[model samples]
Target chain A: MTPAPGDPAPAPGLIPRDSLLPNLEFPFRDLNSRVTPTECFYVRNHFPTPALTAGGWSLTVGGAVLHPLRLGLEELRSLPSRTVTATMECAGNGRTFLSPRPRGVPWELGAVGTARWTGVPLSAVLERAGLPEVVAAWEVVLEGADRGVMTEPVPSPGEISYARSVPLAKALDDVLLAHEMNGEALTPDHGFPVRAVVPGWYGMASVKWLTAVRVVPGPFLGYFQTVDYAYWEEKDGLPPQLRPIGPLQLKAAIARPAPREVVPCGVTYEVTGAAWSGEADVARVEVSVDGGCTWADAEFLDPPMPHVWRRWRFRWQTPEGPGSRTLLARATDTRGRTQPTCHDPARGSYMITHPLPIEVDVRESSP
Target chain B: MTPAPGDPAPAPGLIPRDSLLPNLEFPFRDLNSRVTPTECFYVRNHFPTPALTAGGWSLTVGGAVLHPLRLGLEELRSLPSRTVTATMECAGNGRTFLSPRPRGVPWELGAVGTARWTGVPLSAVLERAGLPEVVAAWEVVLEGADRGVMTEPVPSPGEISYARSVPLAKALDDVLLAHEMNGEALTPDHGFPVRAVVPGWYGMASVKWLTAVRVVPGPFLGYFQTVDYAYWEEKDGLPPQLRPIGPLQLKAAIARPAPREVVPCGVTYEVTGAAWSGEADVARVEVSVDGGCTWADAEFLDPPMPHVWRRWRFRWQTPEGPGSRTLLARATDTRGRTQPTCHDPARGSYMITHPLPIEVDVRESSP
Candidate 1:
C-alpha cells in the first residue's frame, strides 16, 4: 500500500510525515516559550538511537591530531562551556512541496526550530587535542554512536556508522560539541551523551550522539555527504551539478491563523509566524493576504538574534466577503536572499524555500 | 536539573509516566477499537532500542536441537504463521501505588493494552527443529539483540545480554515468535526485526528484538530472569523468597470519569472502563461510586474473550447535593482470583493488583 501523502496521524507535538519512519517534526505553531522544549524539538534520526550510560561512554578525538584524546562525560564537562541559541532546520524542510514528491520523509514547514545549546566549542576541544598545521586538504569527520545501513540511492549499499564530515574551516569555527539542550541534558532522541551543533548549517551536519571526531586528508566520501543530502542541478545538456546541501535557505511560514481555521469576517485578527536563515540574520518578513499578489511588511516581535529565528506578526481586518482567503509569507535574510514563489523541481527535495500559502475560511460572527 | 514527575505535556496517544525514560502507557479512556493502535499501545523499554537491518539480521535457534537453525527474515517468514490478539500487561503495572514507592518506572493504571500479533508459534518452530523428547530439567532461554550492562538488584556487576527463560513445557505451549504487531510490521519502539509474544504472561516475558533461542538443560539463570523481574518476600529476620514474577493479575481500571474531572451534579453520567486477566478469563467486574462502601455490577459492553480485555460501563446518577466523590473498580477471573484492595508491600513493584480509587468533584450545571 502506498503511504498516505503525510503521516495520517502524527504523535502530539509533531507534524505528520510522508514516511512512517520516525521522522518527527515539531509543531512550530505551538512555539510559545523562548526556548523550544526538549519534547517539542524536532527529531530527525537516520536510525534508532542507541542508549549510552554516562559511566561507559566517551568521546575520542584522533587522526591528524598531535595528541589523540579520549574524554569521558565528566572530563568533557570539566572544560569551559559556552551557550548559543541556534536555530536548526532540515535540508528537506519543505520536501512535501517538491514536485514529483521525493521518495523520503515528506516534511512540511514544522521541521525548523530553535533551542539554547550549551557545550564546549569544537575549537576548544581541538585546541586541547593539539591540531597539527597541515597544508593538504583536510575534512573533519564526525561519527555518531548510532550505526545502521541505508537502502536508498541503491545498488551500492553497505553498512555505515551514522557519519558525516565538514570542511576544516567550519570544524574550527563556532561549531559546538553540545551535551545539553534547552538547559537540560540532551534526551535520547536529541543525542543524550553528546552531539555536534553546527550553528548555521542544516541539521544533518549536527551529528547526534557523537563518539568520534577524526581529521582525514581529503574530501569525505560518506553516503550522506556524497549522495543523499546532495542536490541535483539539472540543466540543458550539461552534467547535473551534484552539490552537497550546506547552509539553510531563507524561509518563512505562517504559524497562526492556521490552515482552514474559521475567522469572524468583520473582526481584526493577528497573523503570526517565524522567519529564519542559515548564516545570515533575518532582515525582514512580508505577509500576503492576496496569495502573493500584494505584500505587507510584518512587525518583528523581537530583534534579530544571530543564529536564531525571529517571530513576526501582522494584523489584518477581515474582508466583508464570507469566503476562504489565502495567507502567504516570505522572508529576506541580511544577505538579500528571499524565498521563491514556487519550488525548483530539478533541485529535488533539498532547500525547498518556497513561500507557503495557508487558507483560512471567513464566517459571520455569532454574537 | 531534576526531571519532573509525569511529563508536563505528553504526546498524543500516550499516558503520562513518573520517569521520562520512554515509559509510554496507553490512554485506556480512548480505547476505541478491537486492537490497540501501535502508537497508543504503551512502550516499556528498559534500555534504548537498537536499530537492526533485515539483511544482516537472523534468529539463531541452537542447543538441544538435532538441527541448529539460523533463519533470516525471509526464511522465517516462509514458515507457517498464526495471528493472535493478546492483552499484554507489564509486571510492574501499578508500581506507582506501592507504599514505599519502587525504584523503577512509576507507572500508574495505563500500562496494559491488547494487540493482534502475527508470527510463527514457538511450538511449531521447536517441532520443526526436531526437539529431543528427553526427561530432563530443561528451559528455553530467549535472548534479545539489545545488549546493555545493567546496574540493578545489587552486587552482581557484569556484562550480560538481555535474556530470560521459561520452563520447557511453557516454552513449547502456544508461545509465539512474533514479527508483526497490530497487523503491521513492528515499529522500532516495539522491536523492529522480530520479538516474542508469550500469551498469558507479563509483557517482559514477551521479549522484543529476539535474536537467540537456546534450549538448555536445567533452569536458565540470567540477570533479567533471576534478579530484575523477581519478587522478594521479606519476612522479619528470615531469608527472603526470591520468586520470579509472571503472568497478568486480575485487574480492573476506570477509563472514563478521570480523576479530578468535574461533573455536573444531578446529571446521569456513563462510567466506562476495561478489565482483563491472564490465562483465566474475566468472570465479573464490580464498580463502586462511594469509595467502596457500596458496589454495583458493571454492565459488560463486550463479552469476555480469552487473552483479551472486556469493556464495561455503568450509569452513574449524580446526587443533587454538590460534593466530591470517589469511584473504584474491581475484577474477578474465572480462576476465582479477585483483585486485592491493597498491594503486598514486600512484593516490590511487580503485580500491584489493587482496585484504583478515582476522585472527582461535583458542580452545578449551566443552563
Candidate 2:
C-alpha cells in the first residue's frame, strides 16, 4: 500500500527512487560483499521488462559488414569468451543532490554496482563476421528490445526502441556482447538474454536486452542518441551547445554508518565506502572526518584492478561532544582526472560523481 | 654485471633479492600504478629459464579423466576465455621481516603484484575432457616445464620439475590457464606461453610455463606441494604437525615516506601505502603513526576488488619537535581475519602477512 506523497514505494529490498518505472537502488551498506549479489544489484529500466527467452533470443550483426550474421545463444557462446569485473553507474546516479533537484529519478548514492561479466568481445565477433573496410566516418548503433512512447518535445509521437550509438573505435575496443554476470546467467531485471557491456562509458551506452548491432556509415540521429543523452546549455549569452554524456567521472561516497546515523560518543567506528571512475584507474582517495577541514587518506581493501570499483575504509574516533558531525570522501584517477567540488548548473542529470558528505549525530556514551 | 656478494645479477628492471637464481622483487613504490607493468613485475625463478616455445607447447589433460585429451595453443585459445584481476604474493613475500630469517630468499614487500589475466577456465577444460566419476579422493596435479636438480633431504640427488597439486574442488573453482596479462600476450619472465592463475592463492600455486594437467586419484606428493610450500613445526612436546600453505593472509605496508625517511617537522604530509589478502576481502586497514599508541583508519583509493591488492594513503601532521617516529599498518578481512601483532617463532618464513612497522626520523625545520 502506498503511504504518503513523495514516499518511495516498497519493492523488496530496493530503495525506490521513483514510484513509476521501478527505478531502485540497493542499500549501499549491503555493499560489504565483493560482487553485488544478483538480487541486490540496482535496477534501472526505461520500460517494463521485455518478454524474451534465451531459446528464442538471437543477436543480429549487419550493415557495413562484409558478411552479415545472426547468432543464437549457442553460436555466440561458441566464440572465445572474456570476463571483466566492472562497475556501472546510471548517468543520473546522484541526481537528487543537484540544486533545484533534477526532473528524473531522485537517486542517492546507491545507483551503482560492480560485477564480473563474461561474454565474447565485440571485436572478435566483428572480425569473425568479416569487418567492413576501415573508414573514419563509421558509427556503431545498438538497439535493445525494450520499446516505449515518449510525449515531451515531440511534434509527432511514435514508438521507439531503447537505442544508442558509439564511435567505431569505441565499439571495437573493449565492449562485450555479454550473456553471463557474476558467474551466473543474467536475471530478468538485468537484461535476461543478452546485453552490451561497454567498459568505460556511462550505463546508458550499455543497452540491455540487446537484439541488434548495426555498423552504420555516418551518424544516426536516434531519439536516445540525439535528444535524451545530450546535455544542452546556454553559456555566456551565446547559443546553446549540446554535449553528449560519455565517460563516468571520478567519485567517492561513504557507505557504512549511512547518512544521518547516530552513534555513541568516544566509540571508534569504521567509515567504509566505495570509489570509481569511467576509464582511468583511481590514483588516490582521501577522506575527511571533520567535514573537509582535515583530510586523511583511507586504506584500500584491495589492490588496484582495472575497470572495477575499489572499496575503502577509515576508522573514526568520535569526540566526547554530543553533536552532529560530517564525513567526506573524494577520488582521483591515474589520468589526472578528479571529481569537481561543485557541478555546473547547466550540466544536469548526468555524470554526477561528486564527493558526497555523510552526516552523523554523536550522543553521550551509555552508562 | 655482478656488483657484490648479495647483489642480484642485472635482469633489466628486477630488484634482486638474491644474486644467483634471479629471485627478485618489483620495487614496492612502483606499485603506484594499477596493473604492474611486465618489465617491473617481480620475478622468482628456482632454476635457469626454460627454453620452450608456443609452437611446441601442447597441454595434456589425462590421468583420471574419462577421455584424456591433448590441446594445442590454437585449440585452447578457441575455447571460451575468462579474465580476472587478482593479486599474487610469494609465500616468502615478507620473509625479511621475520626474526632469524629463514634459509631462503630474504624478500621484502615487493614480491606481490596484481594484473588482469585472460584465459580458459580450468573447469571448462576438465568438463571438455569428460570429467571422471565423482570421487572424494581425486586431486589435480599441475606440472611446469622448468626443471632442476634437488640437493636436500635425499638419499640420491635427482632432477625434479616444478609441480603442485590441489583439491579437485579448488582446481575447478576460479582457476584459469592464463595466456595473456594486462590486455597483452604474456612476457617471457611472466610465463610467456601459458601459466596457471589460481586466484586467491599464493604465487607458488600458479605455476609458470605450465605443461601438464593430470587428474590424479588421492594425494600427489609433488615437491612443491609436500615439502617446500608446507609449514612444518613442533608445538608443546607434540609431534611435528605439517600444514599446507593455501590462501594469502591479510596484511598492509606503508609504501611512501619509507622507513628511516627524514621529514621536516610542522609540515603536513601524506602517507601512502597498500594492503591485500588471499581469498577474503579486506574489511579494514588501520594506521598508527605514533607507534600503536593511537590508531587511525586509512583511506582506500578504491573499493575492494575481489582477489586484487589495494592502494591507500593517509595525511600526517608532523609534530613540531624533532625526534624519532614509527609508522605501522594492519589489515583485517571480512572473515574476521586480522594480521597478528607478533608471529610465533616456530612458524618460520611462509605466509607472513603481518603488520609491518616503518621507522621515520622527523628533522627540525630548516632555518
Candidate 3:
C-alpha cells in the first residue's frame, strides 16, 4: 500500500531500502562524526510511523504488577532522566552480502548509527508500579504502537503489534523510555514522544512507538521474539535449540576508500571505519589491505565506551603498480570475541558481523 | 529464450527448477530402489543441451602434457571401463530453507540422486596423454561443450564454457569420463556421449558435456573455480581466504512423511530418509521426533558405502493428541563429521548440509 500523506518521509542522504514501511539506511561513507546527526541516523520501521500525539498518548504499565500505572508524556518527562550515547544496529544489517541471499530488506552495511538518547530510566517507572521480589525471575514485555502484518520467514495472524520481551533484570538495569534524540525532541520517524532504548542489544529490542509495558511470568513467544530475532543454539549431547538473538557480535566496517573507489598508487592513504560490539568495549581493530594476506593495527579515534561504537583509522602505503585491491577490517572486543571471517549460517541473516571485503582499485596516477 | 522444438524435455515426475535451462530435480520421494532410474535422475544444466552426434564428437586432452590425444566416443569406450554407484547432489540442494532466502535456483531438497555411472576411468585416458612426474603439483582442468554467460555473486566477462578443475591426484584416482548411465546410453539432457563424474565432490565438480581436459601448472581460477562454488576459509590468526569447495559434508534428509503431511495420531508410522557423506561412509543416522528434544537411532536399509547414500527408516509412535509436529534427521560420518544442527554461512549457499526441520501435522483420526 502507498504511504499516507501524513506518513513520515526519510531524510535526504539516507539510503532507502523500503519506501512504504520506511526502512532507511545510514550512508556509512558519510560517517564523519561520533554522534550521527538526527537526519543522518538510519531509520528502521516495521510499519508506517503511527500518528501519535504526545498530549493525547499515554504509556500503560500493567500485568502481574501490584500497581498498574499510566503516565503521559509530561509526567514521564518530569521523572528523573538520564542520557546515554549508544550505537543501535539492525540485526539484519549487511544482509545483502550473504550468499544465496536470505530473504529480507537486503541491507548493505548501513543499518547502524550512533546517537545520544535522553530518557527516563525504566526502573524508576517500574518502581513506581511496585515490582515485587517474585518478579525477579519474570520478563518485562515492551509493546509498540506500530502494528503490521509480517510476511517473510512466516506469515502472522492478521496485524500484530511490535512487541518484545527482556529479562526483568535487564529492564530494571539500564533500559530507558527515551523521548529526546541528540538534544532534540524525538521526530515521528524516530519514535516521537517515547520509545525504548535497549543498550547492548540489537535495534529491534528497542521497540519504537512505545505504547505499553507488561510483566510476564514466563518467556514471551511473540512473533518478533521467538521467530524473527532467533538463532539455533547447538550444545553437545543435546539437540540444537532455537534461542532468541540477544547481543551484537564484534564487527568493523570500512567507510573510507569506498567500495570500488579509485585512488592513486604509491600514496599513503588513511583508511577509516567504525567498530562496535554488544557484549564489551571494542579493544582492538585490524585492517588487511592485500586480501587478508597481512594485517596491521588501526588507531582507535574514540574512547572505550560500554555500548558505543569506536571510530578507527589506519594508514596504508599503496602498491606502486596499478591494480585492484580488497580491504577488510576486523574488530576484537574486550571479552576476546573477535569478528568472524565468515558468516555463521546459524545466525540466519542476523548478526552479520563477519569481516566483509571492501574492494578498491589503485590507479597509476590520479585522474 | 524459449527452448527449440528439439530441445531436451524434462522427464515425467522430475521437478523442473528452470524450464529453459532444463535444471530438473529428482523426485526423491519416489526413491524406492538402490539405483535411481535413468529418467528419474536429477539433471542440473548450466546452458541449453548442445546437440552433438557421437560419431562427430571427440574428447581432447592437452596442456602441460608430454603427449596429447584426441579420441572419439567409440575409441573412448574401447578403453578399460569401470562402474560406480554414487550419489550426486547439487551443492545448493536445500537452499530455499536458508532464512533471508539466498538467490539461486531455490531448490528445496530434491536436487540429488544415485545412479550407476559407467565409462572409462579418467586415469586411463590421462595415461594415454602421458602425465609426467612434474605434473604432480599441477591441476587437471575439465572443459565442457556447454557455454553461457553467468550472472550471480558476480557476472562473467562474456559467454564462457562450463569448466572446473581437480587436483592431479584426484583426476588420476576415481574420476570418470562416462558415456553411459544406469546401463543405458546417456540421454541428451544427461550429457550424451561423455561427462566427467567426480565421485565424492558436489555435482558441479563433475563437469558434464566433456570436451577438453587441460593440465595447468598452477591453480585454475576460472569463473566457476574461484568466483562460484567457493567458500571462505578461516584459520587461527590468519585472514580468511576464499577456497574452492571440495567434498560434501554429512547430510541426512527425510523423504517420507513429507513436510506438512497429515498423519493419524496414536498410530505407528515409519519415517524413512536417506543419508550420505562425501568425506567418509555414514556411520550412523538418528531421528528426532520431538522437535530435537530427543533422538533415536534409525535402522539403515543399505550397507555402508564410500560414495553412496544409505537409506534408513525409523518407527515413530505418534502422540495420542492432535497437533503440529516437526521431524529432524542427522547423519554422522565415519570420520566423526556429523551434519551440523545449523547452516554454516561459510559454505555460502553451497554445502547446505545442516539437519533440516521437516514439519508435519497430526490429526485425531486419519482423514
Best by DockQ: 3
Candidate 1 residue pairs in clash (backbone atoms < 3 Å): A7-A17
Q: Candidate 2's residue-wise lDDT over B1-367, tens digit each?
A: 1121112233346688877777779867545666777777788877667877889988888778888899999899899999999988898887877777666788877898888999999999999888867566577888788878644321111456777777789888899999999888887777768999999889988888888898876555454643356664433221233345778778887766666767778877677778888778887888898998999998888688888878877778888898988888988889987888886543446787667777788888667
- RMSD, candidate 3, Å: 18.9
Model 1 docking category: incorrect
lDDT of 3 at A219: 55
**DockQ for each numbered candidate:** 0.01, 0.00, 0.01
lDDT of model 2 at position A353:
66
Model 1 Cα lDDT, one tens digit per residue, A4-57: 111123336775563535678887556555567778788898877888988988
Q: Candidate 3's interface RMSD, please?
A: 19.3
**Model 3 chain B: ten consecutive residues of lowest lDDT:** B1-10
In candidate 2, residue A301 scores what lDDT? 77
1 versus 3: better TM-score goes to: 3
Candidate lDDT (C-alpha), each: 0.76, 0.75, 0.82
- Model 3, span A28-113: residue lDDT tens: 87677889999988899887899999898899998777899999999999998999988999999999888998778878878999
lDDT of 3 by residue, B188-283 (tens): 988898999999888999888898998876556565755567765644211133467788678999877767777778887878889998879999
Task: Please write out the lDDT profile of model 2 over residues A1-367, one tens digit for every residue.
Answer: 1121112233357787767677889888666765787777788988778988889999888878898899999899899999988888888887777777756778888898888899988888888778767666577878888877744322112456777777788888889988999999888878878889987778888889999887876554454643456554433221233445777778887777677777678867777778888778888889888888998888887677877788887777777789988888998889887788876544556777667777878888666
After superposition, candidate 2 runs with Cα above 4 Å error = A1-367, B1-12, B152-157, B233-240, B365-367
